[model samples]
Target: MSASVPTVGSWHRLDRAGLQAVIDVLWLVGHRVVGPQVADGAIVIRDLRGVAELPTGWLDDQDGGSYRLRHDPVAGTFDHVVGPHSLKNFLFPARETIASFVQLNGSWSQTPPPAQVPPLAVLGVRGCDLAALAIQDRVFLGSGYVDEPYKSRREKLFLVAVNCRRAAATCFCHSMGSGPAAGPGFDLALTEIEGGFACEVGSERGAAVLAEAVAAGASIGGCSPEEVEAARGVPQALAARMHARQQGDGEPRPRSLDTHGIRDLLMTNLEHPRWDEVAARCLSCTNCTLVCPTCFCSSVQEVADLSGDHVDRERQWASCFSLDHARMHGHSVRSSTAARYRQWLTHKFAGWIDQFDTSGCTGCGRCITWCPVGIDVTEEIAAIRASGSGAAPPDGAAPAGAPEAGETAS
Candidate 1:
């Protein structure tokens, strides 16, 4: 239970009983248990009650931004690929109230979400999701302003990050250098082994939780050194597999983009033709931002129950793609779809680095995979880069290496 990096510490066979025991320990300590479970025909994170709820043998088949659920008929166990949803939902909910207002006599009273956060144990969180968590932390709990609700809850959660043994076709975390193994931002890291599991305590809180489990008859037998080695190998092997799947023909060399000048690119390319091309294919449903792990833009709205006696204010997820998102002073800054798409991609890959000292994308590929038309971000960027110049000049302006409109490298 000590916070020592054990070459050989406690090893518990991670079977149904062992998993259930850990869950029980987490719950006993007032930690809410959340993990992957079969829902809506796909693996999704939900409130987990027991080991029976975990999707054991379910794997997923994904391609070009499409996903499907299928039985792992051969393994007889479902260790499915990561689903559309990430662990962000529980931490930064889709719909949350920052403050609420109510009418009391002739005055309006305001209330806010509780400052204190409940203990949470997020089980089966993938490496990509973990990376996403780190990015969100920068946005919500970073330097400029700390989001009260997010900051409070983030401090209380216990993360049990899982290595992705099976790579999803839609995943691009490796490109963004976020995953395939548990690095930082986790209290406990888990790797599922053949018979048992290899548990690595990542923090003092993790050690305490493991100690409680060990005390509760969670035996540390049958987890030999070889099992630990094997479990460790799985993550590395998975990483290689993920690397192989990344588009762009092998990994791009570690060359730093001049992110300092990226905002200029965004500002200059306002009238670039690529925006129109993307708009033609985009449904503008706002799915990309909704599933995006780092898109933190939100809007506040007031709701009144049918009784009309009370008004409750709520903060809901907002997307730049929404016309309402950019409305100001009876006019919208970006009413065109071309402008909307440009705003999103440029900020994510470029300006975000200035705003938060990190890239907005961890390359989880959720936005690409979840997009109805299969718009690949990598492909879009490649096209933009291949266009020669960042943007074309207006009217009779001379070409500054900008490609002709509708021209793309085949």
Candidate 2:
């Protein structure tokens, strides 16, 4: 049978059991279905065979430098917010051999790696992550230089987005205009309701895959009036709940970021004292960049076999926090941790606009939760914005207490 396409804006209903059929359809189509599950006390996305693998009945408590998972038997599978994983890690793997060289008769022959990226079906995506994907698309696809590897893998992938019904203490995607509700760039988007899921088809493939699931005996049909209203209220309800928590006096609520004049705000505050203060707490561990959904910092290296006849060029994920990331002529320009932190922060919020016309951050808050010392980007940016000196420090103005020349900083 030919693929069936549902109306783009139409709403549908799917009982909780139908969720497993959705996974079965993807598996039947030879897709390696992946979804979130409880792993090591955190929600992590990994290859999954069925709905039983999902992190159902799990709730996450997220805050600066902390992530803890608790259980509530009645909760939805995707109640957790952004984890350490994102679509970026799947599309752009941590390591890949882009090119290889072999020597024949003392001459080298360069060959590109064969493209064999598997078709992937990723479920339980969030709106902030979808927003991050667009930013990455701008960097790797829309930028003047196209990344072939990224393009090839992206073309063969399927994405299922889930609207966020709850926000983590560290979450600020709503302030970034990215989440609390799943947005575009998904094949299928699901809003979990009391009885089941309210489904929205964002792409023809989404509809076709869902239709396949139905044909395979999955339950799917028109939503009742109440279900439709509940579906529509997902985002608004989450927003109001987050607002109430933030307004209440107690533990920190979902974070909020003021992006007004943000680019100019970061650019003009190059010499803010906050950088030094934060640097005191920063371990320069690269946790923030690694966990960030949109940060694409990486480095390429050449490896050679013992025979010296075979060589391969490999690309590895890198971080600006590394002392060697800014190395030039045997010295790192951003030698101090404070300098490196400044570079990362400015580039994430300011220089990114210049490069990709979008902020490198999606307000996912993985950086905050994963940071060992809990260096919250939102808090840091807020401090700078509040206390920025308003003067553009001269070029190469080292951060406060920066190591002197020829001194190495950890």
Model 1 error, position 43 (Å): 0.9
Mark the regions of model 1 whose C-alpha exceeds 4 Å error after superposition: 1-13, 74-78, 112-117, 222-226, 245-271, 305-309, 390-410
Global Cα RMSD, each model: 7.0, 7.1
Highest-scoring model, TM-score = 2
Please give the distance, in angstroms, between residue 357's alpha carbon in candidate 1 and its true position after superposition: 0.9
Summarize candidate 2's per-residue lDDT along 347-375 as a digit string, tens digits. Answer: 98878877777777777889999999988
Error of 1 at 18 (Å): 1.3
- Distance from true position, residue 405, model 2, in Å? 37
Question: For each candidate, what TM-score against the reference?
Answer: 0.84, 0.92
Clashes of 1: 8
Show the colliding residue pairs in model 2. Answer: none
